[model samples]
Target: MKTVLVTGANGFIGRNLVATLSRREDVEVMRIDSKNSLEELAEYALKADFIYHLAGVNRPENTEEFITGNLGYTQYLINILSSNQKKTPILLSSSIQAEQDNPYGSSKRAAEEAVFAYGHNVGVNTFVYRLPNVFGKWSKPNYNSVIATWCHNISREIPIQVNNPDAEVTLVYIDDVIETFIGSMDDPDASYISDYHDISRSFKVKLKDIEACLVSFKSSRHTLVISDLKNDFERFLYSTYLSYLPENDFGYDLEMKHDNRGWLAEFIKTEHSGQVFISRTKPGITRGNHWHHTKVEKFLVIEGEAVVKFRQIEGEETLEYPVNGLSLRVIDIPPGYTHSITNIGTTDVITLFWANELFNPEKPDTYYLEV
Candidate 1:
């Protein structure tokens, strides 16, 4: 079994990575944070086949402050790993800025140097991946990610400013990033044996074109000091392989995330009259797989006969009842009952139930059966 240690595991990128790793059958993902680094880091490295170094100062107010936070902390990590003599393959999560010159980029480069320099002497197999503007499901909301910020603002009708009209940046979806990370597992082709892999995404999209996409949503003509950009989408197409270039990379699919207008239309039709609620029992399914604590539920069987069984946690008392009433056999089930119902009717049965209070959407409040 492959086990991997993921540092900064609670972060925006780390959380998503953790989820992806958890879904893998061959890998066990262990999470580590810097607060517990002294005790956890060494133990984690010893347990795992790989260490993904993602903990660093990706965000800070000033260049000097950011560099100090990033460089100093990574040096600590490198020293610890080097001294431990743990030859685990170290995969460092770097940003495009590491090779660029903004405060963030510079700090990333400095951090990369720490890893690279250490790798040279220790013979530790180190890999650094530079993430471009990554976006998709579970996107982190921060000022720098203009694509998400702008989309969210437009969705909410909030005002947003656009600048650097044509500042080109590359973007890859979370899924593609996952693919790239997994692809790294494959042996490098004979053509490339360079120690440093410039794994930067091939996509280069002009910022203005992304803005141009939002023209339909623009209520009125608003302008920010931006250069007008026109792109030839066909130029980036590659015959053999899918291009990671921006022109080839499609933007986010909106339908994947929300259905606001449809939900709102339904909302407008709903009114507080005769207490409208929702209830469903799956065909060949049961009710009260567990009962509630605060819900004042009235289960009125509307169709075929059904069996309802429950047990009180307070006593060794268990109760079974046959409910076949078209109307008033509606049983008022109080809370603190562990229960389950099995559909025994010849045909699919239906039960209409309503509560005095809204169902607590959280599932932890209910108890279940062992079976």
Candidate 2:
């Protein structure tokens, strides 16, 4: 079995990395967190086939801790590995700030030098990743990532401060980073010696655009409108935004149009495709005695019993299909066909509806007809 050692196993990226590695059948993981002793770290480092040195201090009280945590800890790890005469491949998660001259950057630069020097002296493989702003679930709010802060505040209805709306940020999702890191472990061709690597898939988004996208995600519940999920950036951001929602707020009530007949609520709507909605029909009630020119629809009875009747606009014969919650079946209402559904059972019927186009009151394609 391949033994992998991960430092800072309790941090955001470290937690995610450990969870991912735990699922592998052929890998054994050694997690070393801040509470672990140096003896424990050394022991794990000696036995590890690969070392992921993710431990670092980004928000320390003093500048000395940056050196101690980032630089000193790396030197300590190298000492342990060198003493054991083990040439294990080491992967270091560095930051984009290393190019700057700040204290954090200076310490990171020193750590990078240590890793590169150790690889040179011991003739081992080492990889360093200069990562951008990494954001995703499990990220701590009010820390290094603006995305995390925005998501946390917005989910709680708290106000967020944006100093520079025009400023753009380069963001790499944690999942993408983890995926690339794991792939590097498996694919030797993807890694090189003493060179800085970057996550292949990253997005550059403006601050204002990020806020707008997140706000749209929040408003989607009442509007029943789904953003264009086909775009990769929006899709990832939307997923990340949803992860920050409060646990108690998992379920939201949809606006239902009520009438003496029954009630209908739109569930989800897309820009190009139609919309999905659900409705309840009173017992012995018939609805949708209409035909469409271009729009088509689908009906599926989720609860109770319903008989769906359809007839071609030019034909006199009516077709009927009985559906219920037991054996869920869907009936398609084609264009140029007059269709209607009647609740035949003793109880109210629950049906799911899908249309090919969003209902436009101005140009309603529907015409009154009898089926």
Candidate 3:
């Protein structure tokens, strides 16, 4: 089991790290933030496998806020971790602009330098990941991201103004960034430099186009940079960037066919064996060479052609059957029955879905065999 600590426990990224990491069974975590109001640092930070230092201001109104809230908090974390005397990995989440010309960027750079210096002598595996703009579902409004504000405008039908549409910037999904940071923990090859470019005005996106992606808006000017946005809405622009793919798996049942033309019809999933369970299979692919102790399943071929082979542990086995018929197909496997399917057609293969019960990770009822 792993015990990790996340500093800056109240902020957007901090909350996200907590929620996401909590899903894993083997991980135990500690969160530090202003809400808890803990005065003792070393006691709060001891005996953790990793320390993700994300406690700091996103975009401070003045240099003083940056110093006291951002750098100061990080420096305090260094003292606590050093005093703890444990060889835990410390991941410093810094912004790309930290060392750049921006005020927030400069303060971040200072903290990054301190982290490196601390790691050199403190016996901690210190590493830094300077992330670009991170956007996704559950993103807080207070975070510094223009993309979230845009999304808010989309949801609220608020009028949007534009300034610099041609500035170039990079944007990545918040989930992806989290995966990157999580993957970096305890990396024996921990290095010093990690750079990220997020969706800021650096990338040229027309003002109307940004609004068009989510909603319709009236704007005379097209696009603008972080500096051009109104100060009254200073924090609004820092919302996470939006992407085409929704965070969850769901959409309309429309064919919504596009350029793929003849291929995607095969990849769609439309079959079910239980009340509700769905998965996709491709042409020339085979699945489920195993048997369930209590799982009885049926597959309905919705597209392409498929052939299934079934063998009962204490009974006779059955030969393959043609599954190319677009009509519903049913093949129920009794307990201790083994089966698998293969696509026999040239096009993509798809099946309508269903399952008797939800799959349980802790108590899987299935067993696999190579043959």
Candidate 4:
């Protein structure tokens, strides 16, 4: 079996990579972190078929620690591997800050040079990824990534500070980074050295846009409105935001309106696409004997038995469709067609309803009629 060694195995990227590698049966993984000694890392280097040099410190208390942790430790790893005459391919996770003139940037740049020189001397493969801001579930908050800090704070209803809302950031999701790292291992030529590799799909978004989207997600609970999920950046940001919510806060109760017949609750509503609501009808009770001018709807019975009756506004013939929990069917209510659903079973019937437009209190498009 191929042996893989990962440095900084407990850090954000390291933990995620190790978790992924552990699930594969073809390779054995050696995780190295602050808990492990240099001797232990050296021992693993001798046996490792591949090395992922991901250990680095971006948020150290002392400025000198950046050099010791990022540059010194990387040089130490290269020395150990070179001493043992091991020419295994090493993948290093560098950052976009390496191009800047700060201390942390200089250390990262020095580490990249050291890894490149080692590959040239030993004729081994080396890959340096100058990754952008990465955000996901397991990232540490208030340390390195602003995205993590914002998501964590907003999830708990804490206030966030934004210095420049107009500033744009290029972000790469952690899953995509991991996928690219894994794909490099499957390459046939492992001895080819590279200066830097860019993640293929990075999103450039303004700070204000991100905050607005996240705020909308928070307001969705009360407003029952959903963001435009069709946008890729919005979709990814929404997923990441939800990942930061406290476990107990996962489920929220929708406001259910009660009537003599039963109850109805709006699940989600969108600006352009419309809304979804659910209702319960008691046995022998009927609901919705109405026709719409421009609003179209769909009805789905998920429990008990329901008979959906529809009649054309201009015709006398009425069509009925029987639906039940066992064999659920969606009945579409076309515009200009009067429709009604009756609970024909012994138990209360549960029906899910979808409409083409959000319900406007001022201008309701519904017209009462008998079907």
TM-scores, all candidates, are 0.54, 0.94, 0.55, 0.97
Give each model's whole-structure lDDT. Answer: 0.59, 0.91, 0.62, 0.91
Sliding window of 10 residues with minimal summed lDDT for model 2: 184-193
Question: Alpha carbon lDDT of residue 79, candidate 2?
Answer: 96
Q: Pick the candidate with the highest TM-score.
A: 4
- lDDT of candidate 2 over 94-113, digit per residue (tens): 99999999999999999999
Clashing residue pairs found in predicted model 4: none
Question: Candidate 1 vs candidate 3: which has greater lDDT?
Answer: 3
Query: Which is superior by lDDT, 2 or 3?
Result: 2
List the candidates ranked by TM-score, beginning with the highest: 4, 2, 3, 1
- Global Cα lDDT for candidate 4: 0.91
Model 1, range 1-371, lDDT digits (tens) per residue?
A: 78888887876567778888889898888898757755677677677777777777765676687777677767776777778776666667788777766887878888878777777776656777787776654454445576666555554456767668878877765556665655554334412211455443456778776655544333212221111222322121111012211343333321211132111001011111212232334446665566667655566666667777777766577788777645448676778776665557665556665555433346446666532
TM-score of model 4 vs. true structure = 0.97
- On residues 1-371, what C-alpha lDDT tens digit does candidate 3 reach at each position? 98888887667677777888999998887888777554644556776778888887866676788877777888877777676665556788888777588778778888887887787776556777777665665666435666666665544446555677655455555656567667777456765433332322223344454554444211211221112222312222223323322345223242223332222221222113224333446667777788888867677777788887877766675657678657667766566767787777887777654456555679878899522
Question: lDDT of candidate 2 vs native?
Answer: 0.91
Those runs of model 2 whose alpha carbons end farther than 4 Å from true positions after fitting are: 188-191
RMSD of each: 18.0, 1.8, 16.2, 1.3
- lDDT per residue for candidate 4 within 1-371, as digits (tens), equals 88999999999898888988899999899989999999998999888999999999888999999999999999999998888888888999999999999999999999999999998999888999999999887888888888888888888899999999999999998888888888777678655675688776899999998898888898898899989687777888888899888888998999999999999999999998999999999999999999999999999999999899999988899999999989989999999999999999999999999999999989999999999
Model 1 lowest lDDT segment of ten:
261-270
